[model samples]
Target: MYDHRKLGRELNLFDTDPLIGAGLPYWLPDGALIRHILEEYIRSVERQAGYRHVYSPVLGKRELYEISGHWSHYSDDMFPPMDLGNEQVVLRPSLCPHHAVMYRSRSHSYRELPLRMAELGGMYRSELSGVLGGLTRVRAIHLNDAHIFCTLDQVADEAQAALEMIRRAYEALGITPTRYRLSLPGPGGKYVADAEKWQRSTALLTDVLERFGLAFEAAEGEAAFYGPKIDVQVTDGAGRESTLSTIQVDFHQPEQFDLHYIGADGAKHRPVMVHRSIIGSVERAVAHLIEQHGGAFPAWLAPTQLAILPISDAELPNAAALARRCAELGLRAEIISAERGSLGARIREVRQVPYQAVIGAKEAADHYVSLRLRDGRRLDPQPDGDVLARIRAFVDAHGTALWDNAARHCPERKS
Candidate 1:
């Protein structure tokens, strides 16, 4: 069994320090690179899909959450409030209330039917020490969060678009969900007590899923206090099922915030709010990828994409030049110098770079390199420029099959 904790240490992705408190994981350079790539890739996708990214405060006045009802509903799960004597505030557990205030900041007309705001926002939630796991279960979180405030008539269309985004992400990343839970309002008092609003919200979501032909089972009482939701449950390497993605419809927040926009009839009307996360917590997604791929990331997602291995000190100059070229082309490359370790010693199997090029006098002289993939496959000797082009094409395609994508196209796997 491949444990993410062990692999995370081996890869130097992140570590938990006791002084920093439990669930606070620190990122290393290599790990930060991977996180950077993930955010860049996902942010690009969001921008293309008509989302406007915003940076908001992670700390908020206690009154802000109180107005949005989180203070009453989830005050225990939230960090204790800080009293400035004049006023009190606490770390935000979610970005929902802040976004509601943002929407309230602007008075809009019917033309702005659907206003979408997005962010890779940082949030905090208080968790017991015993329950805190790796990055997957943490107090500090960066969420792939977005909110769509739209007209009532726009609900289905907006919901469909959100689900489509989730589908595209999961497909490109090779993630498979074990099941979908239609988390409707439960019998418990945890949910908002507006029976009519609950019925309407649940119906709208049910209709959207049916239209998309999605399969899901209804789980009573699994919804958020404010809304009905679609929870994607993925079975991890350890066979533990957890929800890492969600599409939720909230009628409570907008009503509570008294959010309104002008309607076609020139009258003010409340907008229905849709809250979603294609990838819930960014840290958990990274942790999931670590475990799912066993730290053998896809070439596109790999931090140090290529390793320059010079067989002897004689080829050091050539290796350095190759690494420079890769860096200039926006590719991450590392030159494994002989000063630190042997070529064989540096290639520590799975933890090594996804691609390695062994350079010697002859190959350096020829100005061509034969690439060796992590799967032990050798790409035919090609000019440095040509190899870079091929790697860029794979990255542009969001290649998810890892080294296999290269091996299948190559002549053979090298020992």
Candidate 2:
């Protein structure tokens, strides 16, 4: 089992310090780049699916959670409200109420049945210190979260659409959920006591899952206080199950917040809200990816796609120039300056770098670069333009690894 925490330290990805308080892990440049890529990728998918992203403040007034009922049921899991002279506020533990406010910002007609709003936003939760071990469990979390407000009749279809988006992301990342859980409110529990609404929401989620042909187990007392949810469980390399994605159907929130849309009959009707998170937390997902590939990321997601190594000081200019050109072409490239260690030793230091380009006196004069993939496969000197093109093509394809023949084939040798 590859421990992500250990790998995180080794790769200089992220670290926690008491100066900033526990559970608040700060990202290093390399890890920050990886997170930026994840966010951009998910954002592109959301845009294509008609989900408009929004930004909201981390602090919300005390009344916000009270209106959403989080204050009644989950206040212990949230930060203590701060007294600000005139108003009390706390870091938002979830975006639900704020999103509800957005929906209430204007009146809508049934024709605008489904309104999908998304955010890659931060939230703070108060978790016990014992559970705050790594990126997976922390006080600060960010999610690829969204909320869709639609008519009652559109409930099943909208939830299904959200699931499809989740599937697209899971497929692209090569992460598969091993188990599906349909979490429902248990009898006489912390959940809202709306029997009719619970049954209706649970039924809607179940029907959507059935339509999507997903097998799931029903877990009692596993639901959010306001609604039932579909939780996705992925078993990690260590054989431990972790929940990284979820789709929740909430009928209670709209009612509590007095959210309504005008119906076709000109009467007001409450819209069903479907809440979802594709990658539960950007930080945790990066940690998962670190373990998945053992720190050697695929070309598309690797921070430094190609590292340039010069044989000596004489070739530094050529190496730097090649890196600069690659960067201009939108490929992440970095130059490893001439150093005291053997070229091999220096390359080993950044072994996780997807590709390394070595420029020697001859190669520099000829405007060529010798490519060495992370898997140790070496290729003959090729024109600088050819190398960059190959890299760009691989990234365009979202290559799962550096190359199909990164470890075996010599491009110069025929099959």
lDDT of 1 by residue, 1-415 (tens): 5677788988899998899999999999889988989898889999999999999999999999998889887888999999987999899999999999999998988798799999999999999999899888899999999999998899999999988988888877767778888997667666678989989999999999899998999998788999899888887778888898999999999999999999879899999999989978889888888888788787788888888888789889999899888888888888887766766687664244677877866678877777787877776766666677777777677867444353434333223
* Clash pairs, model 2 backbone: none
Steric clashes per prediction: 1, 0
Model 2 gets an lDDT of 0.87
Residue-wise C-alpha lDDT for candidate 2, range 1-415, written one tens digit per residue:
6777888888888888899988999999888988999899989888998899999998999999998999998999999999999999999999988999988999999898789999999899999998887788899999889999998888888788888988877767767778889998887758898889889999989999899999999999899999999998877678878888999999889999999999989999989999999888897788788888888888788888898999999998898789789879899988887765779888987798888999998888888888998888887877788888888988877647566554333245221
Model 1 lDDT at residue 41? 84
How many angstroms is residue 46 displaced in model 1 relative to the true structure, after the best TM-score fit? Answer: 0.7
Best by TM-score: 1
Whole-model Cα lDDT of every candidate shown, in order: 0.85, 0.87
Off by over 4 Å in 1: 338-343, 349-352, 402-415
